[model samples]
Target: MITKKPTNKRLGEILRQANLVSSSQLEEALSEQSQTHNRIGDILVRRGWVKRETADFFATHWANLVNETEKPLKQPLGHYLKEAGLLDDEQINTIISEQDQGKLWVRLGASAALKGWLKQSTVDFFVEHLFPEQASDSPFTKAKSSQKTAKGRRSWFFSQMK
Candidate 1:
């Protein structure tokens, strides 16, 4: 089982960090949320600023990714990405099939990026933030250090999307 440290990050913050939604967009969603009492994810999806799956993914897993405690991830990176609504069944199957047939040594995140299903930055975000141990030797770690410096200035919220 995987366990995470406590965090105060919110869905909007995570989405913003991922470069999925802009600050103005998040502010608009929040303004609407104030009046409707609807979920921020729902508002963002309705506005088309973010995909339903992306919103759902962050809503579900942002906490686990930000936790400071080191816990073993029980599954591969693809598993969490799928649950985060980043990857679908067909995408996973295609990646696996290609790996088996071609004997490709590519990681799932790289495969997904190469196929254009996800941006490289998104995969990098998951690797650097969610699974730091796997990323220690990866070139992606270079960016992680820079991100940590910026992270201190960001505000966080404890509200859940739902």
Candidate 2:
């Protein structure tokens, strides 16, 4: 049976959990690796900062060492974070900015809507409960009534000034 991978909460946290080296040492190794433009695992091994076995282990396991594209959708949030159960559905739901190749899907959808590329029905469908019915003139004016009755929610709804 296959087991879930662990999440990289933070690089520092990973170092702490691994307990292979002190934070200061790890910080120094990380800094040196950055200055030398060398991979962290490689630099740590060269400096004897960590054993080859440990380096190899972290090389494949460390959160920072792996490329994001190496595993997409498999973990959704991330292989390390999600598989480790560190991320929840709510957190995953906020992934509006992540992109692949040259396209940002959310942005593309928004642009399409703004350009009238998408029908009002499509927007309503996509937004789910946020936007009310397309028929703003109908007795289903609960959206407007609510908009006026709740000042804060109204502001929240239309507060994008820029």
Candidate 3:
């Protein structure tokens, strides 16, 4: 059977919900994915953290992003920073490559550090720095609670309908 392709936002939410990624990590990956046309799973795999088959399975199984709460960011690091008025692409690349040796997570930090997207010394500097303030300060809270509350909420919805 053909697998359904979840929207980028939905994919991020799923990963966050599954505890596979923190909200901040998902956000960074999503932002990075948008620019490169790479799937979120692909990048994670490239980072040596996730495997391809598992990603494919998740991609095939989960629902799409039709009702996602937000849009996914996909701009390449340099372009994204430049658009944000943070730093030019070349400068961003130089720092990220220099700092992380082209590692995905490190590169994220490099880009942020170079462009001042976030401070250099932050923990996992690239991963946690610059998390959006509006993200309820915890990106996947809803996703986690939903799993626990699913059966109860569904019953409530059905009772109301009847």
Instruction: Estimate candidate 1's alpha-carbon lDDT, on a 0 to 1 scale.
Output: 0.68
Best by lDDT: 1
Q: Per-residue lDDT tens digits of candidate 3, residues 69-123?
A: 3554332323333332334445554553443442333343344554565444431
Clashing pairs in 3: 31-73, 34-74, 35-74, 35-75
User: Candidate 3, residue 60: CA error in Å?
Assistant: 0.5
Ranking by lDDT: 1, 3, 2
Q: lDDT tens string, model 2, 38-100?
A: 777676668775556555544455443332334322211122332233333333323222222
Report the alpha-carbon TM-score of model 2 versus the true structure. Answer: 0.32
Backbone N/Cα/C clashes per model = 0, 2, 4
Which one wins by lDDT: 2 or 3? 3
- Assess each prediction's global lDDT (C-alpha) against the native: 0.68, 0.40, 0.44
Of the two candidates 1 and 3, the one with more favorable lDDT, higher being better, is 1
Instruction: Report the candidate with higher lDDT, 1 versus 2.
Output: 1
Residue 19 in model 2: shift from native, Å? 0.8
How close is every model to the real structure, measured as TM-score? 0.70, 0.32, 0.32
RMSD of each: 11.1, 18.3, 18.9
